[model samples]
Target: MTVYKQLLSLPENFSFRINLDYLKSTEDGLFRTDQESITRFIVLDGNLFFIKIYVSNNNRLVIETEDVSQSYTKQFERQIMLYIRDWFDLDIHLEPFYTIAKQDEYLKMPISKFYGLRNIGIPDIFEAFVWAILGQQINLSFASTLKDRFIKNYGKRLIHNGEDYWLFPSPRLIASLSMDELFKIGMSRRKCEYIRGIARLIANNQISREKLVQLSDINLAVKQLTAIKGIGPWTANYVLLRCVRYPNAFPINDVGLHNALKLAGSLDRKPSIDEIKQIASAWEGYESYATFFLWRLVY
Candidate 1:
């Protein structure tokens, strides 16, 4: 195997510790991290590569690959850079968000406590969609368990140094599966159908990340995503926030969001949808960040 190394500069005020904390909370079996480095597998151009990323003393990211081939073409480099940028939300400047957050009573302390935290995102649209669907109506812990089982059952794996690195199952692979095959992994029938339905759409090229990005309008994109089976308002907004990187894509109906807000406000009851809307209005374009920080408080 050929070794490849690259260094990428991080944005000012980027907190590797906070981002690692968020990643650690996911309990995803597909990736692993230690105090020094994060390791995951990524598929590019039909090739699987294991990448290990660490923060250097100079405050830049050091990415090393376990592939032996000279695959670092211009396009490959660009893809990796974009993936890293999206994963860390390096493009978003949070100073303005901090300015607004400090003025708001509910968000002030949490924001200060979790300073430099970004909305750690899922860069793959298909992965984001399937994850959001799997999480519906279930507690996060169970959802994570389901995710682990699903990946182990369907995802491709690469073994290195006596460890396994898994790639998220592709749309083509899932689209070819039957309900029984999926159900064996503990997926409900409806969810099985939903995953297959969306997978088929993606495999057939009827929908794609490129197509959605061209839409530009968040509302229209959400509408189109919601039109697919198993994608509701919450899932659509979750995709927008995590995959599309839309700053204002807030899932107001999320139980975690409501519970976080309830705890933050010390309310006797969870706030109603109407109350959530009113309370969230203060954050405006930064609603996703506010929701993410609030989620950290409870989760």
Candidate 2:
């Protein structure tokens, strides 16, 4: 009785196909993807909506969701549009980054290869934090496996069209969880503690996306996140790059980034931190975009 449909216009250089490929890269079970569309449940303003996102024949982005829109306020409408913009990063214009990347030797090929690709964002800061923790120091496949197990055990689900769609576990749920529960899902002891701590911070109103974004600069933001236990520079920057909408965040020590650079430059071994800095010199204002394209090479 509450399925609502909306269409969003795309940028001139946005590629729905490339972003979809990235979303489908990991079957972490948060969303289900078919050939052309993806369906998932998202929590907005404490309301749950199962949404299907896909491209329309007219080249616009379409979102269909189940909710009682008949009596919804304007804030609800704004929230949905804003969430979609952040989720797919629709408002960002790629022309400037493309201009700079087209000249860099290491990035030139990838920029064209993955042209129109946006750094698909995790709008829920808590979900982004959990993902960064889940992926820390592990291969993507194993990290994904852990996430799949964690969500199935702890996250809520909605069944529609005879398929189940999952919602990332809420902060209140994780804050009250025991380590034993998460350990059953194969997460390390430290990761379990870190996740619970982060959840508690958010659930208790100590830290939230609004608070993080209120910081004046990227360093302050990074410092705030890194100040938390188990969140190093790499994890902090990863969160900023993916969730905080910081274009300058660079996780210099990311192993996937090192491998990508090594393969692209034909280096004898993985690039060291110094080499990564020098190689990234040309990627001043758009380090997040640079890293996303490089990650496409190996991930």
Candidate 3:
């Protein structure tokens, strides 16, 4: 077992509640046992099993890792929590988020139920990019099926406590995979090509999280990613949200988000893309959290 302690200084009303709620529900990849101040993740991958137990309150994060200490496990732990904070805009002051939440009825409705969605992010740019491609235009259940197939086929494993936990496959391993191999795992040809493209970029160190972070402007970064074949606005924004950990990253056209907004607002008609943008604008700094909450509505 390995344990690490760190204190995260977050503004008031910076709740991990919503995040916990998300893990409990949306993570088929892991199991979450919700507790008042601590939530646990049990990850099983083939022959390896690992658990991440997160205890947070009053702006402090305590992580307990058991039966796994590979470099990637540590990397996974660091990246996942960081992604959650970035996804929830926990670094930002709560005043602005609260102001928007209190003032805008749409924002208010979602935040009221923010505790039911998961923040699934892949910090590795290649993995995140590939995941976004795999998920495009598909229902999430099918997406999960695709992910399970991919993981089982390509991912590495750790065995502990009579169980297995898997890590997302490495870029080099994925780059060597043939389209036929991926097709056997239920990946479409287009998605296979996109994954290979991402793998090539990572294997070559051409496009990376470090490089993307230095781009300094979200719009420019989005344009750069979209320049990649098969990468669209949703995929770009999803990468920013998951890989770059951009607080304001919002996949405006996400079917889950659109459906969640319609359900929450009790609208006669689903909000237009423009309307969604307009309503989400107030929560600009906390867009990820707002999106998380809205996505929660579906789960």
Per-model RMSD to reference: 1.5, 1.6, 4.6
The local lDDT score (0 to 100) that residue 228 gets in candidate 2 is 95
Give a tens-digit lDDT track for model 1, residues 234-290.
999998888888888889899998888888888899999999988888898898899
In candidate 3, clashing pairs total 10
Answer with 2 or 3, whichever has the higher lDDT: 2
CA shift of 200, model 2, Å? 0.7
**Candidate 3: pairs in clash:** 22-117, 45-164, 45-165, 45-166, 47-159, 47-164, 48-158, 48-159, 48-164, 48-165
Per-model TM-score versus the true fold: 0.95, 0.95, 0.80
How does candidate 3 score on lDDT?
0.68
Q: Candidate 2 has which clashing residue pairs, if any?
A: 2-67
> lDDT at 15 for candidate 2?
87
lDDT of 2: 0.85
Residue-wise C-alpha lDDT for candidate 3, range 1-299, written one tens digit per residue: 55544455545554556566655555443243445433333333322324344546445655544444344455565665564465444555456565667667766676665523334455457767777888898888888888777877787654544555556777889889888887888878988988988898888998889988788778898899899889999999988987686768889999888888888888887889999878886786778767766776676
Candidate that would win on lDDT: 2
Q: Rank by TM-score, descending? A: 1, 2, 3
- Per-model lDDT: 0.84, 0.85, 0.68
230-273 in candidate 2: lDDT tens per residue? 89999999989998878899999999999999887878899889
